[model samples]
Target: MPDGGPVIVGISRSTEKIREIVRKVADVDLNVLISGESGVGKELVARSLHYFSSRKKRPFIKVNCAALPGELIETELFGYEKGAFTGADKQKMGKFEAAADGSIFLDEIGEIPMSMQAKLLQVLQDQKFPRIGGHKEIDARARVIAATNRNLEAEILSGNFREDLYFRINTISIVVPPLRERPEDVEPLVYYFLDRLSKEHRLPKPDISPRLMKLLKGYHWPGNVRELENYLKRLLVLGESKELEAELEAAGDGWNSETDTASSQEAVIEEAAKEVLPNKNSREKQFPSLKEVRDKAVYRVERALIKQVLEETNWNRREAAKILKISYRALLYKLKDMNLTPH
Candidate 1:
């Protein structure tokens, strides 16, 4: 198999086919569209295309269309001259300019606003676009590779996405199968994550018994490889084989076992919460307001979840966004808001 790229890992036939397509498409400059469910590793395939292409030595830029605010989308893609906007104090190079003579991966392409679609199409059609506040046109020498989890056909029918832009970027399309559809790759992926994550965290790798591996393969991973990777990370963090054993038993016997484990999990959570939040008795006579308490709790959980997901994906925000089922832009905002920097 072509192996897609260093980041792509799987032994399934479906995976092999995707890798082959990526290898073939990488050699060409045609705009390529990658279609897959969120967390199915569309960006990895995009990276693979860039990694194997002739432009490998050049910059490989990525822009998440869904993450860019509607008002800023144009300026973000095309450079803006000084005084173009309130914050445009100086001329800034956009993603396209930065990606000159290389490849640009536009993720969540379906979420691009309709108003910006025509401008994007213009660039694709003419390979030239003017800066936000400049009269001169700048040539876009970068090859475009776009990926989306949405059904563009449906978006076109609903008039949400432009058919012209779709055709422009869809010169070649590659669809990555979801994890459930590629069961044969599950075991290999499990071990891969185990080894990588173990080395990453400087922890001992845990052994997965055949029965546990079977249980893992049988489960429907709605979140795809990302979800599997997160699960492995959780296991490593908890340092408990019994947790997976309990989960597998629950899967086999249904809700009864889960109900039994829920209490123990809840106790652990409560203890952790208490450590983070001061005890009521230990607080001063005046208690904190309800809103303050709620806000603190929310902040703690949100920060923790974001940090955990980031660790699992090795700080790949795009994959973390897919697993969290949020826009890539939103994830960035949260990281900023929560001040949760990757360690």
Candidate 2:
């Protein structure tokens, strides 16, 4: 992501098609729905739409409905009157009001509860909504741009989502393909992340090795652009260490090992070993010491356990530390050492 511009960085056909859509539909005052796999940059597309729109000067409010409960989401979107809730100390404007005459991006819109969907639909249809516990109705003037990774049509069929609300928000749809579908995008993304992360870390950008680039392009990134970005951040910090290579190989193996046979597993290990090990015919072949092997094994196991605990706790470091029976400071140190950042 460049400094003040939309994060669409690829020149692939799919990416070009997205640019075309943004150019045509932006400023049209029609609601748009962006669909894609997680981390495929759906929010980037939404921002691009908002950026090119007539309301670019106004606030571009973003709401992640999935991050809050149903009751809280309603209050967050429509606001609540002072003293309406137990903690209500002031009458604050909600996201819709904050986005007045601009764009409101509803991320993870599929995760919105069904009951709230009806209220959302009513607001969208009427272009007005009252704050919670208030009789005065405020104009809903924001352009709605919703993004979802789920199959919303399937969700509607299953009665988890309102069909009317889906139709209301999805006047035009933009689907961002996963990175694996557009591998050409990976190169630019790598360079972009490298430059961006290097600047953020205040580190000189290290030259990316051809072998590392090859590994990056060849590996199937199930986590999409976000995953690639995190790996590049790691590279910036770690400078392509053996541990990083092992982690990448392990992640790739796990992704593909669902149907792998015993022989295939051995083949993967052999290939990984070849990458690290000296040529067999070399007279100066060196082997890792017993302590070195032990340390590496411990590091891998610890990293996996810590990662699993972090994910299970939704990356809440304090909760993860409690679950892992480690001190918060210790966990933070491990995370920094392992370059284990949240995705």
Q: What lDDT would each prediction earn against the true structure?
A: 0.85, 0.87
lDDT tens digits by residue: candidate 2, 119-149: 9999999999889888899999999999999
For every model shown, what is its TM-score relative to the native structure?
A: 0.71, 0.72
lDDT, residue 166, candidate 2: 92
The alpha-carbon deviation from the true structure for residue 53 of candidate 2, after best TM-score superposition, in angstroms, is 1.3
Cα lDDT over the full model 1: 0.85
Q: Could you give candidate 1's per-residue lDDT for residues 1-343 as a string of tens digits?
A: 2344466778989899988898788989999999999899998888889899999889999998888887778888998999987888999899999999999999999988898898899888999888898888898999999999999999999999999999999999999988978989998888888888998899998778788888888776768888889989988887767867677566656644565457654654575466556667864755667787678777776676778779879999999999999999999999998888876
Let me know the TM-score candidate 2 reaches against the reference structure: 0.72
Q: TM-score: which candidate is best? A: 2
How does model 2 fare in lDDT? 0.87
**Candidate 1 clashes between residue pairs 3 or more apart in a chain or in different chains:** none
